[model samples]
Target: MKYNNPVIKGFHPDPSVCKVGEDFYLVTSSFEYFPGIPIFHSRDLVNWEQIGHVLTRESQLPLKRVHSYTTSQGIYAPTIRHHDGRFYVIAMNVSNHKTFYVWSDQPNGPWSEPIIVEGLAGFDPSLFFDKDGKVYLTAGAFPGFGPEGIIQAELDIESGQLITESKFIWKGTGGSSPEGPHLYKINDWYYLLVAEGGTEYGHMVTVARSKNPYGPFESNPHNPILSNRSTKLPIQATGHADIVQACDGSWWSVFLGFRPVKSTKVHHLGRETNLAPVEWSEDNWPIIGNNGRAEIQHNGKSLPLGEPIPWQGKEEFDDESLTSVWNFYRNPQKGSWSLTIKQGSLTLYGQSSTLNDYESPAFVGRRQQHFNCEISTLMEFSPKEEGEEAGLTVFMNENHHYEVAKTMKQGKSIILFRRCVGSLWKVENETEYDESIVVFTIKATETDFTFSYTKTNGELEVIGSGETSLLSTQVAGGFTGLYFGLYATGNGKVSTSPAHFEYFHYLPGDE
Candidate 1:
């Protein structure tokens, strides 16, 4: 079967995979998005479906008011593994400076409350289960580890306690910021894989091996086993990979990479998950891809291809709870939003923080998976205060975003288009609309994004257009992709009214 490079698309990065019998399970970093650590399941390595999230309750993962100077500071990297009869996921929250693990009997699950692994320092942690049933933990160096290097220690899985002192391991093959370590015991040797080059253009995957679980390891002669940094293959910044063996004894790797816009080094979709084939030489070293580079397409005999499900189009909030596709910025405050209060609508109570603030506003969104797509929502809001506003938003972060909202101007309801890049704020366009309900739409292309609105009996009137490059990671400086959703804010003052969204419609363009 021939499979495309990005088997999983849009902002799902730092993929960690583990096989349990014939089924393969994977997890990725969710950054500041609520219900963190998206877990996926696949029969074939090529096709995937989101099973659920590891963190479901605020008590399990508290992200309320989680502020970050950089948009990439929330969840760093996560490693998923299956040992004995249970599945485990270990990760770190960079903004909170904490490390923890969660476990469940099933892949799609009501996971256990976070077992905070105290005294474990640094980010990007992985768990290794030895053949003797002894478990080990490996992570990047921090102030607690003394000096900069990878560290290892024996851990008691049940108690989340370290049974032994942490020891230093491989420092990496002369790359900046060595992180995302995974330990694998294959054949007679124990292999340690880590990502380096800082998760940017120079990102790469390097490996080393040792006879013992913890010891002086030897780096592979072909250091960077996989990378596209030296090529202009549309897929750039490829690294942070995880390896898994199929039931057919074939080795495959799933890693994070991004496709930049043509003729420009800007990627607004963030780092996505890509699939590649792996081969082992007679010398036992693993080889990645055709020429040590990831390709846009891969050919091999894979598990039977499953029917693709259509996840795009209209979203009607008629259910008792929000769908799995919806995510909030960080953790949402208790009772800030609701579905049961309004029949067939999502009601978002107005919050004091705006989208420009580093605090969580009343917002819920889904990722912009394609470069060219159209998103629109029917919103009904009557702001009782001057600062309160509600509408549609194409959000990248607190520092970078665009909003087309319904606000009160001179005691009259009007539509407003606001553009925010860094510290600059400008209301580029506005038009008076007296209706309580209106449809706001944003048409986004590879190069630009246009905002427009429509009344009950009116045509789509163009509000304004802005450069899409301004929201790219190159300009906004974040590790997350674009998100389009509904938002309600009162600037800094609280409001009594709530914003009600009837439905959200999305259409991905062929281009």
Candidate 2:
């Protein structure tokens, strides 16, 4: 059964897959986002379900300096494996610059405490156990110039520590930044797979092999076994891959890729997860595409005809807590946000007044999913002080954010479209309002954003719509995704004005 490109959609990237007896489990990178390393269970390698998250507790992760411009923190690419009744996952938490491993007898685990591996200085670390029962760790390290390449060393299986000396493997093909290395053995050769060409438009996967586990290896003549180079397939970044062989011996690869929306002139879906089949050549080298580069289109390979699971773009707060779809930019203070099922609404408490403030609290948001999606929120904002503000925002970083806010101007409450350009927050547009409860909706189409609002009025009307590229990756120099959050701020004293979020609805297409 041929499957679509993104086997798992929305913000899941840097995929690693493992198979055990008919069961397949997949894990992906969770940069800066809490509850790091999402784990999924699949039977056919095509259809997948999220079973759990690996780093759910604060002690398992170090979150300081998490919301910086780089926004790089928490866990990176994670490698999952099942051996001797123990399911193990090893990953690096860049915030503390350490590699850690967690193990459990079951795939859905009561996982053990993290075993930290010291002296490692790079990202995207992976562990591989050979047939001889020797555990080897491979990772990508920067030599200060650019993305250096892959390094391999023996790791003590019991202690989760490095044993043998580290050795350099492939330094890339002289043109790309080689990272995300995965090691495997087929026949007598140990294969090292590396991603190069950066994670942007030129992203690709290359393979090299050696007779010995630590080697002088040869590059695959069919290098770049998979890529989306030919068409610039809207989804620009498409490398950082991991491979798994299904129980039936069919080969499949899970990797990271993304699609950019013109309206946001930025990516909202984040780095999505993609799946493709691999075919081996007569020479034992892997060839991914029938034509040349990897294709996103499904070719009806091996999938069930069951109806697609309907997904929701909107969320109701008729629950005790937030759902998995709602995630904070960094580690959240539990008491800061809540939803009372009986009250049937979300409450965000006032904290800091500005987005630049580290404690600028009162924030609950969802990942911007589609390029042309519509998001509307029912909100009641009551601000107390002069600089106190509360509203809805499309947040990129501390410095890059756009908001539609209800502010207490003079004695009256007014709605304004505010933006943080460079370092200043400016009121670019505003409308005088008298309503106590308001409904605000932001329609993002192709790189354009339109702000609209409604009171007791029949329907909302657009306040202003303009071309804005508020959603950028770490390139715009922040590690945060474009978030739709309800925020409240105060000048010095905490604002007594409470904000109620009735509901948040995000529709991918106009419905």
Residue 33 lDDT, candidate 1, scale 0-100: 91
In angstroms, how far off is 204's CA in candidate 2?
Answer: 1.0
Deviation (Å) of 346 in candidate 1: 0.6
Q: In candidate 2, which residue ranges exceed 4 Å CA deviation?
A: 66-69, 106-110, 145-147, 261-268, 358-360, 468-470, 478-480, 491-493
CA shift of 303, model 2, Å: 3.9
- C-alpha lDDT values of all predictions: 0.87, 0.74
- Runs in model 1 with CA error above 4 Å? 65-69, 143-145
TM-score of 2: 0.90
Question: What are the per-residue Cα lDDT tens digits for candidate 2 across 88-152?
Answer: 99998777677889988887776888998876655688888888889988888756834488888
Model 2 whole-model lDDT (C-alpha atoms): 0.74
Residue-pair clashes per prediction, in order, are 0, 12
